[model samples]
Target: MARSARPVVHYMATRPDGTVPPTCNHLARYYSGLGETIPTVNLADHIGETVDHPSPGEKWYTDKPFSYFHMYTRPGEILERLEVEERWPVRLWEVEPLGETGNWGNDFAPYWLMSHQIRVVREVEAWRAFGHRGMQVLATLAQLPDLARQWTEEWTADPEGTRRTYTAWEKRVDHTRALTGWAFCRAQYSRREAGLQAANELAGNAAAQAATAAGADPHAVALIQLRARCLVAGQLMFDRIRTGEYEQSIRGLLLGAGLETPAPALA
Candidate 1:
């Protein structure tokens, strides 16, 4: 059977003249080279399309908003311009400079988050909506009140085997894979610290009052507490999708998962 075609996305960057920039042209060429089709349409011609009555192109872009960055100018440049114009009074450089290299503050965090956990979450939601088992693990997490008990049984039955399984699972949900130093900006870090504290408190409460009541192993109970922390961190991340504080949510998740620091800053 033939594979289903991926959706096509259309976008262009406008220069001061309202004409396509070299960057936009470069993207069209790159996508064409890869056997992808990106249609060109003028905003003037597409004015008839509104949020309520979107064209096919608009709908596609809405579903895949990252398409804008995939073929657009550097985010640092965009934000810098906004700062210069005083239209975007938010000075990101005050928190961290937009380094030129493969740096943290540039655009890496957003791309990483989109390509990793955020993408996984959306895929899981889509699968669940369609009544598919592709996202069964997450669904199981939602339904299982005493994940600690379940994990304890598995671990007691197969010590090495359970360690390997949970370790691998932990890596897949590793928040550091999608976060960066941007998440540790002073104010954002404070919020992340608070989220982590809440998770710890919840886990401790569960362990103290409900561990034996639920008949869960101590180690497994710890893991379940970590998972609860992960949930809080994930929610925080989803809340700041388009803000400077975005990375902190991922950071919080990492901390909740017992990670010491962000994953070595991507070398």
Candidate 2:
């Protein structure tokens, strides 16, 4: 049978000044213990030759016979070898008991990516909860302006402290977005209500003239006109809140409220 191809892996090399990522030497030594020799290549040599050239500080391995295929071929063999070499203890309960086991530094790339995704999901959930709360509290059209003022006051009173407390970027953005949304809602509701009132008044005037001609009661016409206005106002408010023009009014509102624009979070 033909020999299976060896696996090629890479790690950051120990620098001339003797500085290196801790995991680099650990992984190189592990593969060396498995009877493989590692190699070093200067990235500058291949910079113009290949698009996917090696990065600086990278060391390459071309002689390692150990592969994922070998892992399954003899189940427990690699773990037994590791334990026998005294490099890793065979503990059943604890994963990564010997700390991080990758070529990268202490901040594992995979875990960092996963944590960022989790934070994004949490921020989205928080925004949804905020929107639901806004719907519950904004019972009347007149409350929108008041609520907006309240948010502005709360934000301005402690802008820096609030930003520091909500360190997440999404949380800060969501706060400004929510305030802009309320302002837009108030403006849209007022515009729609005014238009509807004008139209309703014209129709009411025509109806009142017709009812007078037909000798119908003026008091009943007046009651119907009042009910129409109330119905239109309520429906307009609800529709405006649901489908208001949500624009990027963050800068304007921040300045207007005498609050500084929120800075981006540090990496």
Question: Best candidate per lDDT, number?
Answer: 1
Per-residue alpha-carbon lDDT of candidate 2 for residues 172-239, written as tens digits (9 for 90 to 100): 43475533344334533343222233323433444445434444344434432332333223333333
lDDT of each: 0.34, 0.30
Each candidate: RMSD to true structure?
Answer: 19.8, 28.2
Any runs in candidate 2 off by more than 4 Å, and if so which? 1-190, 241-267
| Candidate 1 lDDT by residue in tens digits, 1-267 | 999986432122222322212213455557678887654322233222321111122211323212222221222222111112221222111011111212124444321111100000010111111111214323433433564455455556665555555455466455345332332232142333322233334444543344445655666566555555454334334444334554554545443433322232223
For candidate 2, the per-residue lDDT at 136 reads 27
Taking all chains together, the TM-score of candidate 2 against the true structure is 0.18
